[model samples]
Target: MVARRRRGAADADQYKPEAHSSDGAVVYVRVQEDGEFVITDDDGQPYDETELRVLRKYAGEGMRDMLQQACDRLNADLSALATVHCDTLSPRDKPAFQSRAFPEPEPQRNPLLQPTLWSRIWPPARRRLEEQNERRAEQYTRAFSEWEEAARAFNEQERQRREQETELVLTNLDAMANILEEHLGEIPWPRETSVSFDLGDDASTIAIDIELPEEDAFPDVEYTLAAKQPKVSVKKIAATRRRMLYRDYAHGVAMRVLGEIYHRLPTVQVALISAYVPTLDTGTGQPTENYLYSVLVTKSQWREINFKALANIEPPATLERFELRRKMTKTGVFKAIEPFDVEALANEVGI
Candidate 1:
């Protein structure tokens, strides 16, 4: 699958002079250097001049639709952070051996029971039949032996696979980490998000560090159709609103990581998640990461949440139920805070 774009650049690039039919039919179109619309058919031939006006009328409407779509995409991206879900991993059934049935033996005839003189004279026919039956028995025995060997090798491979699945289901630290890494990569986040995991002493606890998007990463502009032409009018998002969005985005990410770990690894009782963004240190002038929020989520407390109604749950409000550490103003302006020390906190909590 193609990765989703995190910025508004893709939308901006699509705001060109393109048109479609009023019935919502797709049209191949491009604007020439001379500022003329060139509408083409599936074969790339230009449409007749008589059909140009009808197609051209919907140009403004199409561009307006594109702008509205871009706005909708931005909203959906924000909502996705808090609505992340994972399917539980279960152990596979044990492998069963499939036995190959042996072939039936051919019937034999006796030369002495023959009533015809020709049959009595051709006694070699009975000998040939006996020899053929012997060869058939030998071939069946050899084939069955080969089949048994192949079945043994196949059963061994399946046994190993079943053992690995069982270990993962039981939440072995290494097995959980390996499978979790694979599952995390398959999530379709709007941004290119990356997370690292570590086992906390045992399988009961896991620590996660998530790379948060920058403050300006959230969409800061509202797009609309202009009054005059097939163009979009831009309105800047208020400073306070943008700040709130960034805060929710960070908190949502923290909750998402916690939820994923608890859901995928049922034996994991606790999770330590920290959300951070890349920044330059003011004093040292070196690149560094500034943590926005750290949270310690327990399975018991997490179960109280109505997972079925995640769409209505506000990430910031939901996080209040957990052990969270953050420095933010009432207006949602976040300040850099030190991430929680997972090992020390786990020891203190006696987990």
Candidate 2:
């Protein structure tokens, strides 16, 4: 039985094979051509032939079976990793919109006190004092009224801002599109990719169009050597062999965009993703032409799929729900595959 090599052990000899037993004992096993067995315990120290002979004499016959069983158990554990369930949910900070604080209005106070008895003795003085007090009271009342109006306006502005932040709006859709573009731009690709979101009147459904790099930007297959030997040439892969690789790449990109939209934006229920590659037109032989591939999937439908398990499946098999069209190419001529119409889907859903 084969076992993993033990770490941090001293080199006992240059010729013997070292191994660990099931009981955590490290030993070296050697077979002689004359049908003799040599075994020695390793105690992080070197042992001569005399010490080895003593160790072999004391070693139990049952130790070999024990080590074999341990190795079998380790292999069994490793093989179970393929279908193991994992929690892959990633937590992100919820988006927040803050409103600026409005300035507080100054206090409006009474400008006059009680009239004095001396002022009351003269009618003109008393009248003048009473008129001054009336004027001051009017100014105070007017100032209070202006402050109340300012407070009401501030409150209304805050209410509208809060609604814009939480509810869907066309202006907010532009902001969301900008965010999608910024995120897609960060992908490690040759071209600057972007995505635009168009929200419908229904609010739950969103149409997305993503710009993808040219197909030529991706290599068909990578060359590699079968063995690490001198003067060995690397194996060349056929173009047909790499077809699945390109399909899988496109599939992964679509899934990533879907995850970002449905999970990050909780308001979105159904997302229709259209990915297009800008390349030279085959018919006109002109640059800056597009070949598009589109898929429509609901958030509920995607949530039912096991993403981890689906990762191992072929792209076409995993993306069967999209009803994706197949591209056709023949002898340097290419035909574009039309995607499902987003407007028709919206109308069917009564959006």
Candidate 3:
């Protein structure tokens, strides 16, 4: 900025330059990864917490006007230099500058590509926009035509369906009337005490459902029977299920089985599996001796155990302990330490 003043009757001028972000304290602006301007402190760390008031104070009002003035002045200087380039610098001083001040003159580009700003841009841009609009209009027209065609096709299908519905109703009418006649033909129309035909909502081609009045319209006894239907159906489904109730009840069962084979049965240890598979057994006197790989439980041996994890419930339920859990014998028959029916337990508990 330049200022004029009169001092001692002589005119004087003073100039001041604006401060930049990198002026002092190593404070500089950098573009962050998020594409926002970041003001870094002297230590090279990004500003942590900054107040808008402090920023506003630094980048005070009318800052845009100051920037605009700078740009305008820069443009004016560039314009003057531009005219110099056109009239004098293009063929004359450029050669001089290239020859003396700088050595290279490989046909440098025009200082800034031309018509200064707009003329170089308008022609190609306008042509491109026109072409784009033409393409868009053609696409829109084609889409509209396709949409209209589809709509017409759909409407024609609907019209055919309506005609088919009319024919179906007409064809079914006589049959329906005959059935009604068979059911109520003996009684005169007015003489019949109460005659009602089941009516239905608008139906599709594949289905017909009677729009019966709501359950509230029926007596309480009928509602009770309907309410029991779900429970009865669930009971029937539960009765058909074939699953051991105590299968998941035991903890560390896999570890127990591993311990039993590794610690109890010495020949069937982990390393001897292949040896056992290929060798003959002394007890059976055959390579393929019949052995019980697994035991099946009889209904009497099934134990009632709840294995719902303790951590899930409030305050946790006390874990129940039972001695000598009943198991199936080698014959698949059950030997129970205590007698109990396990299969019907879940239904009894409403689970």
lDDT of 3 by residue, 59-113 (tens): 5332333333333332332222112112110011110101112222223222322
Question: Which residue pairs collide, candidate 3?
Answer: none
Model 1 spans with C-alpha error above 4 angstroms: 1-52, 56-166, 226-231, 348-351
Give lDDT tens digits, candidate 1, residues 1-351. 111111111122332333457776555654432233445655677767666566656554664554445444435544453344322222222322223333333333323332355545677876665576677777767777777777677767666545644554464566666556655766666555667777755766777778877777776665454566644455677988778877766676666666656656666777788878888989999999988888887777777877666667778887778888888897787888888896655753444
- At residue 340, give the lDDT of candidate 3: 23
Number of colliding residue pairs in model 3: 0
| C-alpha lDDT values of all predictions | 0.61, 0.51, 0.26
lDDT of 2: 0.51
- Model 3 error, position 80 (Å): 86
Candidate 1 vs candidate 3: which has greater lDDT?
1
Candidate 3 overall lDDT versus native:
0.26
Q: Please give me the total number of clashing residue pairs in predicted model 2.
A: 0
Worst lDDT run of 10 residues, candidate 1, spans 1-10
Q: Ten-residue segment with the worst summed lDDT in candidate 3?
A: 88-97
Residue 159 shift from truth in candidate 3, angstroms: 0.2
Sort every candidate by TM-score, greatest first.
Answer: 1, 2, 3
